[model samples]
Target: MAGILAWFWNERFWLPHNVTWADLQSTEEAAFPQAEDLYLAFPLAFCIFMIRLLFERFIAKPCALGLKVQANGPQKAQPNAILEKVFTAITKQPDEKRLEGLSKQLDWDVRSIQRWFRQRRNQEKPSTLTKFCESMWRFTFYLYIFTYGVRFLKKAPWLWNTRQCWNGYPYQDFGIMFTHHIVTVTLITFSYVTNLTRVGTLTLCLHDAADVVLEAAKMANYCKCQKLSDLLFLTFAIVFIVSRLGIYPLWILNTTLFELYEALGNFPALWVFNILLVILQILHCFWSYLIIKAAYKAIAKGKAGKWNPLHVAKDDRSDIESSSDEEETVPRSKAPHSSISTNGTGGANGTNGYLTGGTCSEEH
Candidate 1:
């Protein structure tokens, strides 16, 4: 184990040439970040989780009520052991062939079976108030984090000039890193170990700013405030694009990829960190494409005067397309050749979408 640890901590890989671990050691006057500090984060996270529960109950729920966010109770499907078994054990949405077999077995028409499935699916969806609370919780966190981040960064030179981030190179400042699981987490963990927290803060701050708008849009959407939702969604798209595509690569990536190299010279771990940033940038581009596509579709629909409240700002990555209420009104006899076509109705509770998170970094 010690041999493996020694090999992994080789100074040549992690630090700049000629800088040994001894050189990076903390003294009484200059205390460095310790890995043990991370232990506090777990307990803090638990506290936050508990706070979320209370916030959702006391704060968000009341706010949702004030906004008049209606919670439509789902219609329960009549009890049927066979269909229930199929829904639970087999598929929520059955294929055409499976539908036919079930139709024959139950001696029921396809339309009735389809309605049951629709009702069944709706039953599984969260209540509109529940979705509102969840979005509200996220909005509260993102807004607070963004506000705090802005305050923190106001005095930090690198907030204005990215190049200043590398003025002291690796030794003069402490920093943070973040990312998804596996590769992203590895990047974050390595970056934190290397004391790269400054850039990490920028990445996190940029991300939370956009999410604040996204969650607000979701909350507005849940309340059926179409105009507010659409406006907020447009704002979210702009923020997402500017932060993820515009500033992230131009400012953050530039500093990390170029300025850092110029300041500290090449190291194996630095190359690893750069590769992870590039990967994150690629993800940004992919999600940006989704946002652009959604925005274009919204524009075209608006021009054509085919505005759908349910579909307003509906990007599946950011929002899921709920099954329409109008579908239930269609006569059972007029049900499409494929019941599948008529089956996708949004649940009674209005959580009609999802949003991906940002930030590819680790903490202090």
Candidate 2:
């Protein structure tokens, strides 16, 4: 077991040939990333989580209220022990057959059962105000981080010249390095561990830049500012596509995959790093697709042109009624389609953004 651990952690596999762990160690003049330094991430994360709670309570919630964001969703489901059990243990959504079974079991009409299920689902989902607060907190954080990244990168030579990224072949003055989601966390961990801080910092800044717009769009959505939300979502789509697909592939991928090979030649660790970067790019493409789809839907909906605050109440009532109608004959193609960006970064990016089943919600 010890032998396997030693072999797996061999410096030759992680670092470029002729480089050793000692060469990357921190000195009085320079500080390099140390494995043990990751311990700080745990406490820092806890502190940040606590700060988020406070921000949501004292800052974001009040801001949402001031903006008159709705504090509640549809009415709650009435008590139904059997339905609750099925919802918890079986599925939140029941098929026609299951609904029939439930209707018969509860001695209720199918429509009531469907309404109960819908309300129950809404009950489990976050209120619009809660979503607003969450998005507000994220928007604030992402905006701050992007600004800080710009300030930090202004002093970085690589920010101006891509070739400067490979100047010293990974052993340079410790400068650059730096998310919360699983994908973000994984990227950060791998980049820092490999001492690819410069590239990592660039990625972080790009993502944060996109996230600021994305969160703002979400907040606008929850606030029922349809025009602003559509506009912001469109803006996010452009930014995400430009940054993640165009700039990322041309700048980051080219530099890491092709330029690095030209500069330093191939190495096992470099391949590993490049592979991870390629995977991230693939995810970027996936997210761009979703963002574009959502943006296109926004344009089709004409939300930017037809919005009226006074009409919202009536529209919302219609929306709820249509959603609750089980026998409605609306075509599946015309049904409102929502695209979620999983990573939570891009205008609508996050793990929550662009996977097969991303969690990021682009509710239109």
Candidate 3:
């Protein structure tokens, strides 16, 4: 396969040159200046090329198979299509009326319309899995570019100097550390008060989980601050979990168990303590909700930042179209209204007279 490809490439670009194959081989030997070196390097280069070709053909090809092709050879479609499809499906329904309308509008069969809806429903959205994988791949590619490309550009002083600042921070700043601490403590406290220790613990765990992702993202840029962030998150998780679940629970259980041996006269205090414990547990649950909400917002904003405005516009358009379709299918009804009137003259004097209102007015 390599020979075939090489032959095609030779014919396409090399054979047109006046140089003969023997002359090219001689030139290659001259450039290396050592037969043993040439022998080793030639086979190594060939093996590397073969591996890369196989990877592109087998792995990358399969992964990209379902992506839409562009006009210029096979390329993935613009990101807007995926976003549009999701929003469109969400805004519109697969009702008989809307499906029939779509069928008539597109000149497709009603069965085909139904099939299309099913296909769309079955088709996966741009899931977190795919997005995460793609981002990692891009980050890996950028790392390579920064590593080797920087070394190559070093020969050109201007280019090297221009990109010198590509290096990221060595350590996370105090601000980030402080924020993490605040968030962890606040979430823990909230969880304890709301009686949602489990949920709060999960929230803390997610913060730790996000550190892994954030570290990977920083690694793409060859940033060393990732370790600091990782350590901070890990510390927060450990401290929060141990304190809330371990230490606190142990203390409560020990007190309650010991109090069982106390006199019945102390029962009222024990009951009050139990009540407070329940309240604390409830507060902890509320705290957990806040933590989850905050984490979700943070991740969502980060992802949203990467999306193109054009993609967002496409999503908005799909939503509008879907909403319009739904409105067309839905039956409209008038809302009931009330009315009132006032007489110019008073009933028995020169005062103004009042007429009973519609629904608001009641008979004596």
Model 3 misplaced regions, further than 4 Å: 1-18, 26-28, 31-119, 156-364
- 1-364 in candidate 2: lDDT tens per residue? 9999889778878777777778778889778887676777777788889999999999999999999988766567778788888889865456657755765565655545555665665565566677678779988988988998899898999988877887885567775455332223665676676677787777778777778887887777767776787687667777888998888888888888887778767778888888888998897877676656655664688546333211211223213321424343221221122112111221212211112211122321
Model 1 / residue 252 / CA error / Å: 0.9
Q: Which stretches of candidate 2 lie over 4 Å from their true place?
A: 93-105, 179-184, 300-364
Off by over 4 Å in 1: 23-26, 169-184, 303-364
C-alpha lDDT of candidate 1 relative to the true structure:
0.66
Q: Candidate 1, 172: how far from true, in Å?
A: 3.5
- TM-score: the better of candidates 2 and 3: 2
Please give each candidate's TM-score: 0.78, 0.79, 0.23
TM-score of 2: 0.79
TM-score rank, highest first? 2, 1, 3
Put down candidate 3 lDDT per residue, 1-364, tens digits, no spaces.
9999676435223221232334323242242111132244456656656755565456544444433211122112223353346438673335545544544455544433333333343233332223333434433433443344335434533232322211111110111111112222333443232222222232333223323333243222122233443343334334444444454445443333343224122323334445555565565445444433433453566531221211211222111111112212221222221001012231123122212111100000
- lDDT (0 to 1) per candidate: 0.66, 0.66, 0.33
State in Å the error of residue 202, model 3: 49
lDDT of model number 3: 0.33
Worst 10 residues of 3 by lDDT: 355-364
Name the top TM-score candidate. Answer: 2
